[model samples]
Target: MNKPECSRLYKVATKHVCALLLCFCLSLSGLYRVSAQDIELKNPSLETKVLSSMLPDGWKRFEQSPDVQPGACGITQSPYAGNTYIGMMASPDWSERIVQELVTPLQANKTYTVSFKLAYPPEYFSSSVCSGSFAIYGANELTEKGEILWKSPAIMHQDWKPYTAVFSTTKAYKYFITGPYMDTICHNAYRAVLLDDFSPYMREVPQIIVQARNSCKGEQTGSATVRVKAGQPPYRYRWEPGNFSDSIVKNLEKGTYKVTVTGANGAAATTFVAIGENELTADVTSSAPICHGDTNGIIKLNISGGVSPYAFSIDGGVSYQDEPLFEHLKAGNYDIEVKDGFNCILNVNNFTITEPEPMEITAANASAVSCSSVKNGSVELLVTGGVSPYIYEISGQSRGYDNVVSGLDAGDYIYRVYDQHNCYVEGETVINKEWRDCAVFMPNAFSPNGDGMNDIFRAKVHDAVTEFRMAVYGRWGQLIFESRNPNVGWDGTERGSGLPAGSYLWVVTYTDSKLQEIQQKGTLVLVR
Candidate 1:
């Protein structure tokens, strides 16, 4: 061999031997630090050091060049947490990474949380846009890649940003990596990721928890409590069936209730609670059927469970009342509702009212001879309502169902009917004897210009008159006023229009008590 070639080979061998010796020493140091450290991963903050390279002591680089820097990296800014941080180059086809094995393996079917500080320095511009992310892998041995248990979306920012990833695993995870996601960063052509203060710990995800507050037996204050546990605070709660924001809801019905609690960090959880039959109810009692023509019907309501100071509604939805007693109601059906302090409504649809058995008595005419003398009279009564076999008394004369009194002196007579149910009805009949001859008197004049008195042309009738009628005609016989009723009069108007002051002729006809027909004619004057 030539002397120059031998010298070059000797130099190459010495360089490799020194490199191997340095790697061996760093490995031993990392092992000792890991055994003595409290953190699951040795040198978790990247505090350990090795000379001749930009790598930390306990971390391994992956497939590409990555560097650790104290102040800046290619115009990038300083570290976020410690004295030194790692920087990696990312592109479409390749990305640099730093990976480590945890001292304690995460249990299967368990949750964990990881946090890290990251930034894309504004002074360092590669593609004008950069993004990076982190992930956890479930593996028995540390590898470049494995089954991913959790991952975070790629984030791009110029200033230091804090990010957290919460995830669950079905397999024990002993390895974790932080860098750019190759598939996403490649689209932007190239990106530089600055990572510092990488931290991983076993932490449970936010969970929505529900607790029950059962109401006392036969009460409606049954409630459910909603909460978020083991998650970030400042939680927001929403309930089903309504938009209630409180942590506890009262006066619940017998059903399932759901609540969603959202954490401040956008984590959410849902839980459910159930209520049973220990709620409020309304009991209504109705009175017996009120007899027709009575005003004493009643309905009373009783409520149990729930809070007090209840309100009521009976008109379907028209109004609400605080009283529970309903009185003077007609015989029919009604729907009732009761509400407690919690605004829960108990609806009763079967309230009923009915009429009592009927009982009635009617008395007919008493006889009289004249308008000013004593006379013999008769009273007849018709009995209705209640059971059959009724008894009646008239003017102190008692008899059976067909009650009749033929020998009654002139006066007022009282008649009463008693039914089988012992219910009674009373009535009065007068045998008048001082009646006068039938006649109708007409008014001579009237002033109907909005006057308070004497504004109508009306006629007065005497006693013993069966029927009377009066009609007024104009001077030209135009038939301006007509009436079949004696009490009905005319205002000095023709067809609802005021007539000129003038004299009008009237004719009155009537049937008298003696069955005689009388007719009279007269002139009535209108003042205005």
Candidate 2:
């Protein structure tokens, strides 16, 4: 807290403020240089008390003379942020301003935010103080009044206060100025305010806030949202791969995504967001159908992981149910799926409903009935399929492990075969009467000449008749030929001697299917 040997108190009284401005301008270039962006100001807090030789060290006058406040100005309050402060005011005609050549020029068409501390102390200025607004501007030169970047409302605060201004530059700016707000209708009386502790000088970069959601296992169901904060309006957005230009992106898998957001003034920022992984899995236990060709199967499913409120589908998403139990499924292979609240899906493809093999039986080698009225037919049965060791039955009669059934009548017989598991199949077979009606016949005339035509006389017995006999007699009533075989023939011979040609009498007798004897007599001619 050492006192300065000379302050601006004596210089302002003698009106030597021009001498002070000339000294600061000579030192402005020697103070510092900016390497990157216009990110900071020189002597930002006005931290100087050499009022006799300098006008706020790095600052120069743009309008009416401004005061680098000295002890005589009567500000009892300590500096709001630094060792010293500066004061500016509006005269009867124009407002006073202080400008500084920025270390580097700001990029044109880029948005920026500037902040400083301001206060109004009546005695801080030279005796005249009426309420007035504060203003900030961007300039190309230190002498000209640049375009107004921002203007505060009438500031009447007694204590130190903070103010912020955000604006887009029309051109690349070399100098920045701060002054009291003034226009045509400005206050004619003097109005003054104190400024101290400039925050910084830099283009505004928007804040990027990312909100990401997890994705489904083996599916693309995640999401992310990019929000721009503290930047210009009508922001433009972009994403990688798809080149999507929206705030929110959806249907993303487990991966990191990059997004760039650009403000209206062409200031942009890039950020990365990540969508995590979620495992959706399911296990199913099923019951087989009760019997072959039955549809009474059931499945119970248990699910784990992922979001809640799950749904299940058995018939390939055609229908869905909240419960995990499924019923009445046919015997076949199946693929079951479950969906979670986030629409994540899990599928189990190895599910089956099985039953015993169907019963198969073949009825073959059937014996025909001997007579039209008898039940003497039989059939051999072959059983396969179904479980092992099958039991056979015919006409509702259980057979003791016998595949053959005798004494089958001429009708349709219903048969069934039972597996060891009590699974049965019913089938049918028919027994037909093969032989019944028969009659014996003989030709009357046959030539005995050895010309290979009509040389023998025999009875045609259809073979359905048994116990056959045939005989022939000459005109003298003597036996000419006799035979007990139905197929045997008679020639015109007597005792191995050739006989004369004459008419002969023949008789045939045979037994029918009912064991009844049949007799028949006829006359035949023989040629010698």
Candidate 3:
């Protein structure tokens, strides 16, 4: 061979020897590349601290060394992939790179797709870091960086960024190389670009398919079967909204359902299916009760959609009827369900049944009876709530047309006030007989004959009395004598005319210091 030919062969031979020696040294140091086919790209990330000159298994280096990092050269960036990733740096001298041999060669006339991620910062060292780009190349041997296959633009981001590359080849290549790319030589600077998680040669998994049956208007008859088209065996299905794992969903309502399908390769795909039904709705109107404790309240439903002959239920579907107007209802809240002929139901909640504001007697001012007598109490009521034009009644007593009733005995009495709507409220009040300390005395049987004593009938009083009145009635209920002053006396006669004497009824009414009106009545004998 000529000198030029011999020199080329010698250079090529030198490269092979260096690669073999380096590989042998790496094998001894437990740092050699594992064949791609043997690992199937296993442990794409490193588990232990690795040197800057070392590459993890399933990777190799040509002229320049790369790093399996996050622990070396002052780099602490978290792995973008599994645990550790590659870092390629471009310096003022040359761009750094890493290479690997392929088990399956890149075929001619076919396109291949792959993806990788790059990052620039958060803990940088060993060089003055700056923005940089990367490139991928196809070669025939570990000693060469052959034809450029794909190139990325400048990577300036501080966080991880992904790039997907698709390339077609005319020559079948046997190796893959990735490196930081430099258009021109940098001056006194270094750019550190991270590379990670190159996609394996995998065909895209197909999308999920679903077959479904819609629900009837109100029936839960919907069903579905989710199919994972074209993937590895042993797939797991995860359904959203209910978190079910079965491949088939049954008895569904009217809503959207989502599912995620995962294969053994750890690839996942998600899709959704909706089950539709005929719409059914209603508008409810409730009427308040006319009288308290009356069950005449009504609730009406004006339903809009679905089939005719609708049945309504206010008891949570415990019972249903065809009538839309429900009467004889009490005051309370209700949840109603309207069912169509097809048994489809629409729920309307918070249908309130109300009554009138209760008839309340705001105040009842009662004057207690006196211990000296029984029927000397009085009560006055201030009424509210029920309709106007209210009439008052006291049990077994006359209240006339007013709310104030007097002459009440010391007892528990039921008082009722009726409104114009005939809606009445009854309440019980107690009139207690109180002992008065006032010095007032009256005789039950006294003779009114002209004598030294007991001739005139009068009451003796001392302690604070505000007002007093006295009246005398004959045996036939005739008002024979009346007086407005306590000091006045009755001589058992009418006006100034003398009359026949007999047993007479005397009534006395007085207002005490406590402003209580008290009445007392008894019979006194008028001896002739």
Candidate 4:
């Protein structure tokens, strides 16, 4: 309760506080000393000396404290008398040594900054003391084996203040040395130079953090979020399944997806998220087949009942995210497989494709014509057999000439017919009689003179000619006349036109009255 007691208690508390403070300072000092030792210095000293002379062995001196100009009062006396000072003196000419000590062992592709403190004594030079310079060396010989990393012309004043000159190490040097290369042209003789707090050049590597997700929702309401540490802001974020935007993924499908993040500083990071499933069924469809050659028709398959965005594949091929429609398919069996929103694939049953058949050519009789003679004969052919709307080929030839022919011809020939399916049948009969001259044969020849004689070339035997084609060529092998009807023919003229004075070859071939190719060839002389 007395003043003396209160004062004694306060003193005791002060003593304890002082002891704790002392202990804290000692601990901090020990840590600082350890950290300083790790900074390998070439010239570790706390004395004022020319940086060139302080350099270790193999180092050449560049410059020292050489006198510049004389003056009564200089910057050496007042504000600049602290730990930092600047002076104008010739460099130790040891530019080589400086470089060797500071730039010989730096790594490639690394970024680093150089830093050091400088001060100028106002008493050493006139108030006009303007600037100073320094150099670095990596080799003792200082040949072209090193480079200049930094230079400065710091404005000098009458203050002992700290200044820093920064530089970066190049890939050519693995180690380096640094010191002052002075050019002090002062008007005072008391100029002083001091340097301290020189930081060892070092590079800082950038840090990256990448994140990813496994799956996401598959419907309109489904979504996934991805985050990454890509350095600075204004980062570019992009999603694989959609356009690039500043968005956490939304309404995703059941499948794998990727997200890329790029920062403004050219740094990049990536993340992934997968959407959930929502569907189960798939729909398949195909165009109607027209013929065996209609293989390029579109075949489409749409999936549903499982997920929104589904994966698709055909016959175990590479999987694609978009709905697929195949083209250029042949007439055969096919299988299409589709994956649901849950990454589940369902293989469809085998489906067959059939194309329509072409027209067919058949014969009503098996009869042959004699050689080198005109015969008054009738032939029959059936074209309405096999697949409906069929195309046929009819051919016939003599016994010796096994090359079956089509159309009507004056010769002994056998007949053969083919249907739309490329299937054929043969029929034959022997003729023992010879014909006379210029015989007007039925369904064999027609004179298209336009005088009501034979205006049309046609096969008019009796039975229906299913598939037939008649063509007439000029003497120059050019098709001058053609007729598909059995009642049409070429007369003495070229397609009812006046004939020139020349010999033209005429050929008639078909399955005449018989279901075989009857080929006939003859020369018709035209008189003007």
Candidate 5:
């Protein structure tokens, strides 16, 4: 072997290396071309419609059942981004779904980001229960079930909101489907959602460089430098508090600074830097324990002269949170500590959560009866201890505050009382069969003044009266008032004139549940 032979071998190897390099560059070019291709979607806005049957141009149905098929219905609100949007009914039975094919199959083992706008239309039908959630799925083709890529939290507003999800697949995907989760049933009329502007694109992860200079001794400001390493150039800089457009920002205060660099192609990178901070302090305000509930109380912290992105710990440096408020704490003392972005820590100790006075409540049912005639009975509650004006709620009956619950059929009932602080107490009562006799009682005297109590001369009926009649007369027996209903009462007035305070005669007749008929005569005194 000689030097000339060695030179020839080196040249051959160099040629092969150069050829491989060219192929690699060509492959990179092809990747960019593929990404430039739009995700061919038919009727992306779901604008195609036929009568009450709204069928988007390119979407497929989950089922062939005419009664359960997906279609467009007129919506009062305008679409979020286009003229038409797709909707689905979520129910206990098979949920209605809208499906469509993707123009290009998703590459196997590749990651893609998907985004769409969804809304819960405010208009509702009979039996519509407010349900605002649905799921997105991916599969090779349309089928009864596919891979669940995303299930969103319930959407509750009529205004449209954007939702996004990212997924990586081992197999190529050719279809996109939307519907309720497999286990969720849609018996409520509110179980519907509007979807528009669906999109899928390959997401690019970015690589960037960021450097910062700390302030020297006696210096009050620092500087930061950012440079792009692998992304497209002509980058835009968004520096916190400064909003500077250049890559270099100087004269920043002694704290923390963050900058986001976005490339012309929509790729972005974020970096954070801290300057100087000697010490940080945290102050806290503790809330006392609630009166009678499982969630105990709350504590909030106020941080002054510290770096951004604060972390808090209820215990002594055991755990931390980004939020400054701590809730659902038991009645006891606590030690709170907070740390800033610069690792500077501040601790607040000896905080106590006091317990509020207990609430007392009692419930009773008047004229108790069996389930067949329980409406005749009334439930009365007496509550003490707790802030006022208190609001009351029954487990299945009352929605507002009431001392008496009437016209209820026989059933076991539970009630809750809420005060100004939203603290609550719960109690239970029941109505059962125990028919009681109904009787009429006449008051000996009455006052017609505007005071809330004893303001009318009326006969009181107890237990359950079927029929009642009452008559009032002057001293000479001149009929001054008459009423057929038992609850109707008379004020101290004749023909719209205020009568002088005096004694009057009253006669009453009533039919009780236990008696056929009865009559009673009594003398009444009226006073201002």
Candidate 6:
């Protein structure tokens, strides 16, 4: 027969079978047995009683064998010794009738294990006839009814066996039907299919839990849920600031907090309940000013009215357990910071540092005075009332005295004093008189010869000189001869060695014992 003829005949046959079953059920007059044993058929035969009707309401008949036969209702092949068999196929595309009326209605928001007895004729087993799936629909008709509740492959053994599938219902549904979509190698040829005792199972929901936040306070205060599976999505959470809607509570003062959490399924759970109090307090004290050179100075900072383990910080860095002693601070203002167990920081407290006053020199002067007119004389400098052990200097051109007057100088001259602070008083004097007869005398000319006549040139001092330096230079100012002690005055021999006769200029300077300058300049001739 052509497809249209075959389809028309199959429809007629399905209507007849459905009408017979309906009439038989109606005639029973509600006298059907409800006993579990009566309902449970022991090894029901598929070939004999399993009737093939049109797919349940709202389901479209998908595939079936062209040759229909009567058969016992067994999960697999025919169970009876001799019987005829008929098979029916259905698809879920039609308003989800299979899942809505059959599978979903049985689940009711529960987990389930569903099982069915199904079989396919050997001829249907091929690469093209391999696998198929079934779905349980929900009320929304738009959404997949229940879950994709179950599925099976078209390739089944000739001997039927029970195949099972399991799924959990996340939402409730009013009706459900099982959809069986099959692939067949017999393109134009139809194949037989069978099903029996489709059953569903259910299980309880899992538990929910709450985990407390390990720490809390001020800006750094908050708690978190704990003891949860690593990737489990949290269904609900609440903190002290609010109820079930809020996941995190902020702006917390010092206090204990409570938290509660619920699982997705709304089962098994936990909560953290406690009074959170803002008991934190703090205190600060100003530090004393430190001198510039003082490396160790105590800055008094006392923290009170709070928890222990107070932390200290000079700036906004990591807090330290103990307060630090500041050292080597430049001349300026500084900010000191202190914090408690919580990460609360005190604003910058101003501390001033003053530089030590430069070392002071109170007084310095000559100790005594002497009246003298010569290059050599003695005078004691009484440099008292100054900032300790002053340093003294006599003028370089001052004759008859030491260049540096540490303890004292003997002269009729001046003294410059420097105190420990490196501050100094310009040249000062107690005696203002010239050293008597201290003039430096040198012959205007001389002759260099073997004779005992005026063959050498020298200088003479009338009084005893203390420290003296003299030098003779050619007209161009290049030094020819020099000397320090007056007793070791120059002999005009061109640095104590013989030289060609020439005219030369001489200069002499010395400080007397009284710290007076004895300076002289003249010209001399050496005739060789």
Q: Write the per-residue lDDT of candidate 3 for residues 198-294, one digit (tens) a residue.
A: 6654222324689876776766877779986555446788988888898898888878999887765555667889988757777778887888777
Better of 4 and 5 by TM-score: 5
Reference-based lDDT, residue 284, model 3: 78
What shift in Å separates residue 365 of candidate 3 from its native position after superposition?
A: 88
Best by lDDT: 2
Residue 51 of model 5, lDDT score: 23
lDDT of each: 0.65, 0.73, 0.70, 0.45, 0.65, 0.46
**Top TM-score hit:** 1
Q: What lDDT is obtained when candidate 4 is compared to the true structure?
A: 0.45
lDDT, model 6: 0.46
lDDT of 5 by residue, 1-528 (tens): 422343244345445544554455445433333332224455556664332232455565654211111222334556676566666556555366766666566556544455678777544333354667778777775654777766888777778888875555667777777765434344434366777777534333134567775543234546788877644456788888778778888776676778887655565667787865435556778777666444668899888865677889987888899999999987777888887765556778888877766677764544465233225566777777667777767774445767776655566878777777777777777766545444567899988888978989898765455668899999999999999987689988889998888999999887765556888998999987
RMSD of each: 13.8, 21.7, 17.6, 17.5, 30.7, 15.3
Q: Candidate 2 on 208-296: residue-level lDDT in tens?
A: 78898889876688999987755655789999866889999999988888998876645577788888877877777888775678788
TM-scores vs. true structure, each candidate: 0.42, 0.38, 0.32, 0.32, 0.35, 0.34
- The sequence of per-residue lDDT tens digits that candidate 1 reaches over residues 1-528 is 522343245345446644664476456654432211112454556654432234565576553556665432344466676667776666666556766656556556544556677776433323344555545455665454667666666666767788776666687666656565556334656656677776633344456568876554455667888765456567788888767788889876566777877655545566777776535687788775445556667889888976677888888858888899988777778998887776656889968877656776644656553433223356767766765677878756786667666555567878877766556778888865545543456779999988689988887654345567788999889888889876589988877789999899999888765678888898988997
| Model 4 lDDT per residue over 1-528, tens place | 422343244345545544554455445443322121122333222223222112222222333222211221233332222232222332223221232233224444333344455555433323332344445554334344445566656436433345543343345464464544445453232223444445432322222333322232234545666554213445677778786475466555556667766555433455565554544566677764444455655568866665456666666646564666766676667777776554555677676554544334444543433323424333454654334433323343232212233334444445555443544445554333334332223333445445775455443343324345556666898776666665565554554566555666556555643455666556554443
Candidate 2, run of 10 with poorest lDDT = 1-10
Q: How do the candidates rank by TM-score, highest first?
A: 1, 2, 5, 6, 4, 3
Of the two candidates 2 and 6, the one with more favorable lDDT, higher being better, is: 2
Model 6 Cα shift for residue 29 (angstroms): 14
